[model samples]
Target: MFIIPAVDIKNGKCVQLVQGIPGTEQVVIENPEIVAKDWENKGASILHVINLDGAFGNKSKNLEVVEKILDTVSIPVQLGGGIRTVQDAMDLLDIGVEKVILGTMAVENPETVEELSNKYGSNRILVALDSKDSKVVIKGWMEKTEKNASELGVSLQKKGAGGILFTNVDVEGMMSGFDMDPLLELLNAVDIPVIYSGGVTSLMDIENLSKTKTFGVVIGSALYKGKIDFIDALKYQKIL
Candidate 1:
């Protein structure tokens, strides 16, 4: 599995929040494009970029930074956050985003998923199945739903999403280990590619995750905080 680095932009800066909470900025840096290039230099094969401001409904100029990041790096980038409309997803993909992730849009306007899939091919679309308290949450993890991750994964896969981005919000950004059973269940529930993110603290976490069937894992605070070396993640990805 690929150990993709996350570049979450909030209020025009690269910030990693704890559990997707607004005030808990663990790693904040200026110029996200530089961070993107740095991650690629450290041997990341792909990047997971999120617009936190967009996710929370603020109209920030983060897209300009995203454009700069696209201009800065050659590796494929998959982005999520505030991509609510079909035009929004198309604009990002037309501008060079390899994949556009859908959250609330996937649940509320599922037909759009099929529309995008038919228009751009399924491989360009990823539906996020982020869970909190074992229930799926959207709109920056503030809006909760009764549906669980695996249930929604099956639904979205049928909608023609090329992949599933499963973020276990219960353990996200805490640097604590996570249980793999729920993840395994989601993996068993869907035939599409799955990308996981959350509490990954050490090389052991990487090794353990590499043993799973996920296509990749998105590491943010742990990588930015230097808990796990990016080069080491790449090594384990190769060997496993």
Candidate 2:
């Protein structure tokens, strides 16, 4: 399994939210370009980025920040949030994002997902399914939908999504380790690669997940707040 460090951008700054709550955010650093470069230098193979503002309603508010990171890091970066159209995906890819994650658009406009998959291929398209209590949330986890993560995962595969980024919102940023049940269910339910995110707190968490078939792990607050160290995490996963 690959260890992917997360860089969530809000207001053009590196920040992390507890349990996906907006008010619970804290700025980790002012310059994410430096942070992304540091993570790459520390041995990260892939960088996962999220636009919190875009997830909420502001679109591409942090594309500049993403651009800066791309300029600084040699590793590939996968981005998600407010990517609602084919043009949006195209623009991000053209701008150097290795992959574009479709979250809200996957649920609300699967046709766009198909178009993007056809245009960019599945390898460049990832569907992010953020869930709580089995129900998928959209518009930045602010709105809960009737669609469950498993069901969404299946639909995205049919629509040609390259991979699934399964995040358990209840455990997100809680540092309690990923909610494995949902991850397992989605992994079993989908044929595509599933990248697990949320609640990764220790080397044990990484070890436990390493035993699974997860394509990668995106760890944020735990690593940022010193609950987990990046180098130790890479070592635990044998990536170091």
Candidate 3:
């Protein structure tokens, strides 16, 4: 599995939010591109970015930050949050982002997911299924839905989604290690690549996740808070 570092942007700074709560955020860096370049230099093949400000509204708040990162790194970047329309996805791709992740759009407008996947090709479109207690959450994990992550993953796969960014909302930003049981179950439920996110804490978790068939792993608070070393974790996962 690929060990991808996360850079969540809010108000142009890198921040980590506990359980997706806005009030529980802590800034990790003053300049996100500096951190993105550091991760890229450390051998990150892909970077995971989330626009926290955009997720809460329909605005794209972190475009400039994202553009800075794109200018700094050669590695592929997959971005999500506040991307609700086709033009939003197209604009990001036009700016050299490798993939655009659709979260709320996938749950709220399933047809748009299918349309974008078909028009842009599945490879450039990712469906983010963020869930808590088996219910998919939208609007930046602030609203719960009746759809379960697994069911949504399967549906997105059928709709031609390239992959699923499956995040466990209950464990996100907690540094308690990933809730792997649900991820494993999700892996069995869908044939598409599933990128595991939330609660990654140590090298052991990376080692364990590497043994699974998931496409990749997204590390946020664990990497930023010094709970784990990216180099050592990648070494343990046999990536470097």
Candidate 4:
């Protein structure tokens, strides 16, 4: 499993927010390309790049920064946030994004996942299943859906999605620790690999997560605020 680092971009700057809020940024830094490169240099095999402007229905022209990030990092980059349609996902893949993550689009237009997967191959498509209180949330977690998380996972898997990016919205950015029960439910429900996010606080969490069937864990606030060491996490992932 890969211990991926998040390089979330908002207004052309690299920032990490509390539960993905607009103004509650916990960490902000300039030159997202440098941040992406730093993570690559440190040991990240893949990077999670997000376009907050696109996800939140804002207009920040984040694609410029995303392009810079893609040009800066050699490691495979999996990008998400604000991908609204199949063409957008396809265009990014054409431009060299290793994988394109779809959240709102995947849920609203399930057939698009099948189209993208069929065209780009399933390995190039990832569907985000952001969950809150066991229900799926879309559009940057601002809106909630009546859909159950695991049930959606099964549906997306059936739609030929390559993997799932399961973010527990309830605990995201809290820096406490994630509950394993919910994660296990999704893992048992779907056959595709899942990369978990939210509430990843320490090395113990990393070790425990590494032992599970999770594809990888996306470390955001905890890793950014120094609650957990990225290199140490990488070492643990390799050792296990």
The candidate maximizing lDDT is 1
Q: List clash counts for every candidate, in order.
A: 0, 0, 0, 0
**Candidate 4 vs. truth: CA RMSD?**
1.4
Those runs of model 1 whose alpha carbons end farther than 4 Å from true positions after fitting are 238-240
**Shift in Å, residue 61, candidate 4:** 1.9
Write model 2 residue lDDT over 45-162, tens digit each, in one string. Answer: 9999988888888885888888899999989999998787788889999989999999888889899889988988889999999988789998888889998898989988999999
lDDT of 3 by residue, 95-154 (tens): 999999998887788887788878878988899999898899888887889978888888
In candidate 4, what are the lDDT values of residues 1-240, reduced to their tens digit?
789999999988999988888899889999999999999999899999989888998634699898999899889999998788777887899989999999999999899999999998999999999999889999889889999779998998999999999999888888879899888999999998899999999999989988889889999888889989898899766422
The lowest-lDDT stretch of 10 consecutive residues in candidate 2 is: 231-240
- At residue 89, candidate 3 shows an lDDT of 84
Residue 86, model 1, lDDT: 93
Worst 10 residues of 3 by lDDT: 231-240
Q: lDDT of each model, Cα atoms only?
A: 0.91, 0.87, 0.87, 0.90
TM-score of each: 0.97, 0.95, 0.95, 0.97
Model 3 clash pairs?
none
Model 2 misplaced regions, further than 4 Å: 236-240
Model 1 lDDT per residue over 1-240, tens place: 888999999988999998999999988999999999999888888889999998998634589989999999999999989888999899999999999999999988899999999999999999999999899998889999999999999998999999999999999999898888889999999999999898988889888888879889899998889898888788877423
Q: After superposition, how far is residue 91 of candidate 1 from its true place, in Å?
A: 1.1
lDDT of 3: 0.87
